[model samples]
Target chain A: MQYRISFPHMGKYYIPIKKAMEAFVGNYGEVILPPPITKRTIELGALHSPDFVCVPFKYTLGNFIEALENGANVLFQIAGDCRLGFYSEVQEQILQDLDFDFTFHMMELNGKNAKGLYEVFKAMNPELTLPKVVSTLAVVVRIVYAMDGIEKYIRQNIGFEVEKGGFERIEKQFLAEIATAETMPQAGRIFKKYLKKLKTVALNKPAKPLRVGVVGELYVLMEPFSNYFIEKELAKFGIEVERFITASYLIFSTQHNVKKILKQADGYVSYEIGADGTDSVAKSVVMAKKGYDGIIHLKPFGCTPEVNSIPMVNKISEDFEIPVLYFSFDAQTSETGVKTRLEAFYDMLEMKKRGRAL
Target chain B: MKAYLGVDIGSISTKGVIIDGDNRIIANEYLWTEGNPIAAVKGVVESLQKQIAPEVQVMAVGTTGSARKLIGVVLNAQIVKNEITTHAIGTMSRVPDVRTILEIGGQDSKIILLRNGIVTDYAMNTICAAGTGSFLMSQAKRLGLAIEELGEMALQSENPTRIAARCTVFAESDLVHKAQIGHKKEDIVAGICTAVVNNYLNNVGKGKRILAPIVFQGGVSKNVGVVRAFEQILGHEIYVDEFGHLMGCLGAAVLAKNSGVEQLFDFNIQEVDFVTKGRECELCSNNCEIIYIYRNNEVLDAWGNRCERGLSA
Candidate 1:
């Protein structure tokens, strides 16, 4: 049976995930990237989802439905901390109730019999060996790191580019070129070529530009469409953007450094506050100490972990005297409200900068 | 006699002002938006034009408010700004030492904190539109009272009743239950005002240090009942400028003068036919709704597309 597998979108991480899935599925099936998240996708997701589930649930469920509609027979969802751990089971049940015939695979990261990359790939294709699985996973990890590295550079300098759309044009080339790479060396070479191309993009940066740090829930922070492409909006006003959470950081770095993250928060948060909440608090402290002009906190409406971090983040803002703006998204279709608040926030920052200079 | 023109096109009302180079108000007009900001702005500009002296030429134009971008294009504005900054600038020009601003408009409310004439921190009400001007207007209609009469009636209360102000749905049911149980009408009115003030403080004003010399503005500031409730709760004097409702446009005028870009702002914009059409691009799943502004049947500007594909559409 041809297994047409699909997964939800989360930024450009799809490129790497699709690459890994292709190797895992082998000749058994093909990977179907769900149509890019659109207004219709969100509306369909919200219509069938539980009335007040976190937005990522609705988004992923919508992606699954679209994929199923497009002839996908298998869906993959990764288990997560917070409400995300229970998502796959509920989503599978929801899809079954909708009468779609498909297989649902939920990968667990932590348990007595936790499923790792090799186990997951082997389960999908019994013909796959340990060496091939390990090699493909290595290439996938490199792809994610390169994407994140290039994105970090883009966010800092995109606003100051001498020629408009120059950085974005190169980014599109990077994603397209990296997708065709078959081996680890190919992936590494592609990344280096793009990084050099990105550097050559002429920038008209000022000595001091307005800087803002973004810290928030894992899903909304990573998914640009989910948050109305806010980082791009900030760059339009020439504000240098700094964000700490990335797929690589969360997967490879965060789990082992939970205690260190909490300690770095400087007593603002002492215990694990579930998922990325502690990380959000900790990054705010680091950003504030770094003298960022402002901090933007984003979260899905009623997200427990991110919501839990607000009071502590506010306290940090007060003590550090840095302005923090908070935004909550819930199946939002209108961009006016977000733009209005962002512009006001920018105006305030500019005035504050002028005042300080005086 | 060069003058600056500023227009504030908001959800509820459209306000306009013309000021001399020294920032003295030459002419101003305030009118209801009535769901048609373009027509309302034309009305405001025509009225302001009639009020201005013939020798005073309108130079640079600035726009601020919810519909600022659309109206800015309509007027060939030198600067299109958000209402928060415009309000702060307008208020500071009048009350230079103002440390805080409490503003509640039709659909939104915000708290802006300033120190030494620069905005330090600010927050606008999020998600919930519980205790804004529209909230008061709806409750007034339920009570079979004119919106203007609500403040006078509220001020007459000796013992105000308590109503839930956390959410509009809850507040409405609570108000009905109070009335059903024979709560005095005046007391209920006063309670509603207090509820609006409380909701603003608890939500928009939360976690901020609201220092002294605070100025209150927006459509809600005209309500003496809400103003009194604010005073009773904060225990601080709230100064409502005589030109409180015009502050947004006043700030725009000031910004235009300071922007150093002088364009002849013809009052003849009232005669120009402007229309906006929204087209939803179906090329891909991200169906971006692109808005195109047409002036005299010619495409002037377009926005709201997420990608270049929609630009062509």
Candidate 2:
């Protein structure tokens, strides 16, 4: 019997996860990607979610329900440390009470080790041999790196492209090409070819553009739908956005670099605050030192670590003579209100860029 | 003869102004929105048109405030901007070297920091609207006094009783308690004014620098009591223009003139038959509620859908 496994979406990291699932499940299991989030997804999640849980929880829960409706029988949940860990047990209870026929698989890594991940793959596909699993994992890791390499270049230059929607059009094509590649070398080739094509795109960006560094909660930073496509809005105004977190960065690199960031975040941060808090604090200081025009601290409502970091963020803003805009987003937040704040923030940054800062 | 028009259709108040090439305010009007932005905009435009001479012809129009998008579409405004930009530009045009602007409108308050005629930073009050003009007006009504008298009475207080203005409900109860304890009428009023100033500084102006020349405007700025409290707390002179409340509208008009997008603005919008209607789309689960503004049964604009497949922004 085939076990249809479904996973939650984080940015466009679904591409690599899809590749890994294809290799591991082979013909035994079907991988279901929940549809792109909308107002209905949020409303569905909110009805069942605990009133005070962060928005990411609500969004992912909504994903599970949608996938379940579409014939998904197995749910793959990544319940790491922080409030996210509690999501699995609560979500399992809710789905079971709803009388859905699904097996929930909660993947909790042993401090970012691959052994736990191997077990997860084995649990899903009992027939998978160790050597085959290792090869698939290696290829999956390379795909993550490849996706990150191209996405990073796109974010920096998309705002300045001479032709409107030129960057997105090319990236859409790249996503299509990468989806078909099976081997690690094929993925590498696709990334390099796309990288060169992106470089040739005509750009009319100035010598110095208004640059904003965004640091905050992980889920909010990674998901555009959750943040109301803020990065896209900024790009519309030709403002540079440096969001320092991606799926590859969070999963692969954060394990090694978080300790170093905590040390660098001394005086600004007291301890290892959960859910990218240390990284947010450390990244803000680095962005300030790098002469970024402004900083934006984004968080979800009732986010403990992000709330705790507010005072320090403000203090850093004062010390470094850079302005900071804080946004705590929820499902209830109006699109127009967010737009107004963004316009004002851009206006302030432009004024400062013209040497009008107080 | 050439002129520009600006309108600020806020949640509570709708303001309009007309200015010439030199940025001179030739006509201005302020009217309560009364819960309908489109109706309020038409009313304010008519009021301004009546005040101005026939020789003046509005070349371009601009809109600001909460209902800027709606009004921009209604009036065919050449420029639509947020409150921060218009407020700073409005105050700077009047006080060329002004460094700060404090605006407390009917239901909301915002602090805009400017350096050499450009906004550097700003913060808007996000919590409950306790320290707004409307709250003070309600408190004045409960005490059987006109809103204007509270400001005048506050000027006479020798020892103002302390009232917690952090929350509107708490501040109202505290005022009632102070009155029961035999606190002087003027002192209680003065205390309420002080509470508003304290709340404004604590929440909106928390981390930012408050510098001069500071121009205090908005509907609340008309209250002398709040002005005096700001002066006492900051220990600096506060400048209030006669038309301080109309600064946003004025800024819009000025920006419209400078926009260089010349569109013949017909100020006689009262004669136009315009209305907006909304309906939900059922093509997807999103159920996007699309709104269309119709002028003489013709679609002017439509927005609020998520994807290009439907009628969306």
Candidate of highest lDDT: 1
DockQ-based class of model 1: medium
Question: Candidate 2, residues A245-305: lDDT per residue as tens digits?
Answer: 7777777775437667876676788677776777888889889989999898889988888
* Candidate lDDT values, in order: 0.90, 0.84
In model 1 chain B, where is the ten-residue run with the lowest total lDDT? B263-272
Question: Candidate 1 lDDT, tens digit per residue, B150-192?
Answer: 9899999999999998889999999999999999999999999
Docking class of 2: acceptable
Worst window of 10 by summed lDDT in candidate 2 chain A? A109-118
Q: Which stretches of candidate 2 lie over 4 Å from their true place?
A: A109-111, A254-256, A263-267, A355-358, B137-146, B153-166, B169-189
Q: Which ten residues in a row have the lowest lDDT in candidate 1 chain A?
A: A108-117
Tens-digit lDDT string for candidate 2 (B205-310): 8888989898999988888999999999999999999999889888888888888889788766888888899989887888888989999999999888877877
DockQ, candidate 1, vs. native dimer: 0.62
lDDT tens digits, residue span A1-358, model 1? 7889899999988898899889987987899989989887898899889988999999999999999999998888989888999999999999999999999888764322223656766666889777777777778777887899899999999999988999999999999998888887888899999999999999999899999999999899999989999999999999999998988787765454887898789899999899889999999999999999999999999999998999999999999889999999999645888998999999989989998311
Q: Where is the poorest 10-residue window by lDDT in model 2 chain B?
A: B304-313
